[model samples]
Target: MTDIKDLPKKSGPSGGWGSMKGIKRIHAESHADPAAFDTLRRQNKPGGFMCSSCAFPKPANYKPFEFCENGAKATLWEQTRDRCTPEFWEHHTVESLKDWTDHELESTGRLTAPMRYDAATDRYVEVTWDEAFQGIAATLNRLPADDVVFYSSGHAGLEASYLYALLARLHGTNNLPQSSNMCHETTSVGLKKVIGSPVGTVIWDDIDATDCYFFFGQNPGTNSPRFLHWLKELKDRGGKIVTFNPVREQGLISFVNPQSPVDMATGRETVISDQYHQVRAGGDVAAILGMCKAVIEVDDEAARTGGELVIDHDFIAEHTTGFDTFIDFARRTHWSDIEHHSGLAEADLRAAAAVYMEHDRVIGVYGMGLTQHAHGALNIAMLVNFLCLRGNIGKTGAGVCPIRGHSNVQGQRTVGIAEKAGLVPMDKLRELFGFEPPQEDGTHIVDAVEGLIDGRIKGFVSLGGNLARAVPDQKRMEAAWARQELTVMISTKLNRSHLFPGRDAYILPCLSRAEIDEQATGNQVITVEDSFSHIHGSTGKRTPASPKLKSELEIVARIGKASLPPNPKVRWDDWIGDYGLVRDLIEATYPDDFRDFNERMFEPGGFWRGVPARDRIWKTESGKAEITTPPQLTSLGYGEKDGRYRLITMRSNDQFNTTIYGYSDRFRGIEGTRDVLLMNQMDMAELNLIKGDKVAMVSDYDDGEDRRLGGLSVIPFDLPRGTVGSYYPECNVLIAISHHDELSKTPASKSVPVRIERDGLAQS
Candidate 1:
């Protein structure tokens, strides 16, 4: 973990010897035993556990070694021998541990027992399971339904999420906000509006059949390394890959399949992207519009000369609506405005579009790069609009693929983890559970923060995730969280959020995804839905780290039973004993998708939850795919006035969400620190700064108060001018709470306006 003083070139192409080295490093860090290696072998297998790292879909014929480097890291991390026992809590006070870094906090190891914060002693005391559940229920029962929020991370399996949602609904609250609210809510909101489905339409075979891929604002190398295998295969098969992002990510540039013997022996790497465009932060809309404009202009020429039509007019006329209105907007947009806003030359965009014109089957893949902005939903709609122009939405080899971060984040939402009442069928819920579920929309992360601050929210319950560190405006969020009446965290490991506990805070230990869960019926298996809407069962054989930890499903059921009066229709205790019962209920709720749930659990690759868009069916009011235009061709709302730079936050290779694995981001050539700022050499020169210069960053939000983070090292690197990059969580403080997407309310963590000053600069 030595610090590299100077900014270095990327060590090598993604996923060669570098991946093996990463795996080894985590093995050593986790102190993994040979048994852990045995467990790793079972990952992503038919009868084994699913990888808890990312939500990338598994291939039907997955290789013997199906897992990736990040997956290995996540697996080993959970199997670590370290335990945060009652003795550990006795030695350290919550107030004392507040100064520890996020890595240090989680690294203290897995929680071994349920613990409640004792304010008088400033420490957490171990509590009995009954005590913990009853106490939490008592607090919840006394609070207003809307005042208590039930948050979950993607870690919860399908069974767990379904039961958890039922618990909230039975308790008379729809405040079900989870981790997806921060990363990919825009995908769910935007795609559903356009094509009647929120998830990606493609499966593994679609990637195989496609000849071209348009990757946008996503780095699969660090976030979801398993996707690199597909990119490499696409490249090897003579398919083209074009990338649009603010950073020149190595994952999109090149990759070497570690599983390939020849590649490992020769150290040969397959070049991935045929063309890479480093667009400015928050400029995706303009760049996408430029490409759409090129396609339309080419179609106009074909129409005049009786040439082959580039716009797929026949497909547009039959399957979609608003083509004329959308094309007119693309036609009227000035090229100069596109170039200025996109930070890409017209030639580069036209050339990229030419690649699109050359291929009929294309897959558009994107991540948070397009989602965490003021117009995040519009960004996604515009991307679908571009695909619609070429008849790509419901085609065999073409579609929009929004790569999700969490393994079951989408699954959680599918089974009923949502804030809006309209997102789920309330009539079905009431009929099934024999209870009237709340119809009012619940609070999102942003609204929850404000409610806590203003005393409108009194209780908070989390299934997983480090809330304090994962959200925007950390300084403000922490203060608001401290004021809550009760806070409950159901997690395996300790996180920073535990430190900011409310007056009656409790930490309940839960089983990790890769651990065995034995119940009253027998050993149970859980299910997860991948990014492509494929549902599969995950079975874990590993021993639990602690005997005290309960399954998340059991915990949620116990909480429900302790809190509410017995309802014969909703059998909480029975569902806890046999998870199949929970699946049956899920099938009853989503009969179209989850029919024969238990029977299909043992299937080789499970089944698809059938997105209507895949079959050329639109569930929208118009009953046709809509290709609407955004109000403007630009995505950025905040202007870079007053010499402020657009600050973009990113994740390093060593981390997922707010969970820090190590200090190094090997793919970015950084090590031993997460506080460094990545800047263009030209921008550094103009600011009279060089590599290693310490600076303070002050955010330029319209909010009345100033948000500042100081003591950041400046590192010259590859980025667009007038834009700089830094790691997330630490830089999350610079993002104002109000600065979020208008449609989805996802924090604009990717783009924020800021001014940098030397550490010792005097105030104005």
Candidate 2:
């Protein structure tokens, strides 16, 4: 009929005719009404709902057009009219739905009402909210609190997440693992240890003032396109941009400003990166070591010439400790090792380091690429080390920015959504909530999965996420999920997780950020803190997708009251009636930052929660910034071996975390299917595999079952030799639950050692 959707080419710049075409195509979908789309336009204006896309700071000043392509897609996606009503569930079995792809499942539309699994029918039958809550409460009350894992996602606002965490603690369990456990936990774990603070220390204004911008492992064009405007401005101001990643992402290469009508009309684009180094997957530690080494040599050479030394000696002596040890370690690290591991030549590394040396105000940017690894925490430490060496912290246009993967993910942690104690502190909780929280740390996602597998965990309550699909080792996770006695998903739409039912399961449909939350008090606007620590309130302009749907805050409060009856100390009813009381609690808890939370949020674009690290304030045990030597290079992954390639899992351009917008990944020039593995052209040729050949890949892990991925199309791509790439959730099969950062327990989804063999074909 039509040409196959497999068209692989060098991806062109973003935000031109292609973006317009994409917008037109998306809007043309039968379910997205034009009038509703126009209605959403006004919502993005002043005093309107915040875009639930990326957590990039909303501009302090307003523009007529505020959201980007993906943001619009997210809006339309939530506001889709393709109803998955009770009748739809009546006709389709869960087994039949399982055959459908993630795209088909979500596109089925916003969940209309609560659904409970029927064992005999093998389907989710629509049920009343009271019936669903009663069933959940009965099962939950029957189980031990320690066996319950209360999880949150990026979708929930601060009020919901805070209430989620508080409910868990009140129930006498600290097992509150959210999306951060899967995405940016490493940044939280590492940055707190290094820079004396967990959150990023830079504001949105820093992007414009930065002289040299280093994007370590992020692709902002697809993840956070608004950031491209800042990059374009930086380039226009004669600033240099360098990127170090395993793949030469199109976003990092060039971008056309959608805001600039002239550029879009003329098809003119701005080149983003001046230098890009294709580091081998899992080689971030080595790459950082190499950069550190080059900077050391450059500084020495500058000193020998009787010129200004590149190293900030005064800053190192006064602001940082362990500089001498780091200096010695970097100097001793061999160039051969760096070159071998990073796949970057000595000259390229030197040139990158020279760029850093050339600028006084440099910002280091990184993403999940650096965090979803075995040495993720170490990788974060190295980036901080690099920035601190240049007197980056507590200065204008200079700091480490760990670009997070989801909106409001950082805020969840700020509102005390941690597994460990001392973060929010038991004393603080006691004083704020008038009750004592659990003293010890609880389970991470990995540990929670293991608990389920080993028959330790009995219940799981999800605030808003597809845990079964987002988790590593889907097979194992699904199996573990099946064993739970009770499972609950408080979500806006149906996803893969709802299908993997436990003995008793309930789906509590909740309101999306795009839908108005009308409570007993009044219409409520929830607050979320951005990646840059910008806090703002979002007021949904549209009516509820379904009249039966409850806001996440309401869903959480109901569950809390049902499962654990209101204690005299904590008035659950009060917080549920008025969200302002929730803000009051938050302000009372973290008074220093959230003192004027309500007043400031109602202001233009909210307020910036200041960074302690930016003021030369250290909260470390030693009260000084510390830069220890990075872990050995052997820690990256299984080293090079014949026919053994490193596999890194990534999200397609059209996807957001676990939500599939479409089957096509237009940015990477692929469509229709996601069953392809991107391999280096030379690696494919060496393995005697063609572009469309099917292959079976086995992980290097010694498990007898052989963590294997079968029937995958091999697509030749532009990547470093000995490295291959595949989409996550599919390739998540290869990642062992145990394979994670030791400190953070974040699944090492970015790097895996694997071997591929031709399937039912002879060598060409």
Model 2, stretches more than 4 Å misplaced?
1-9, 39-46, 760-764
Residue runs of model 1 more than 4 Å from their true location after superposition: 1-9, 760-764
lDDT of 2 by residue, 636-698 (tens): 645566767788888887778888887657777778888889999988888877889998778
Task: Please report, as a residue range, the 10-residue window in candidate 2 with the lowest summed lDDT.
Answer: 1-10
lDDT of each: 0.87, 0.82
Query: Residues 397-425, candidate 1, lDDT per residue (tens digit)?
Result: 89999999999999999999998889888
Per-candidate TM-score against the hidden true structure: 0.98, 0.96
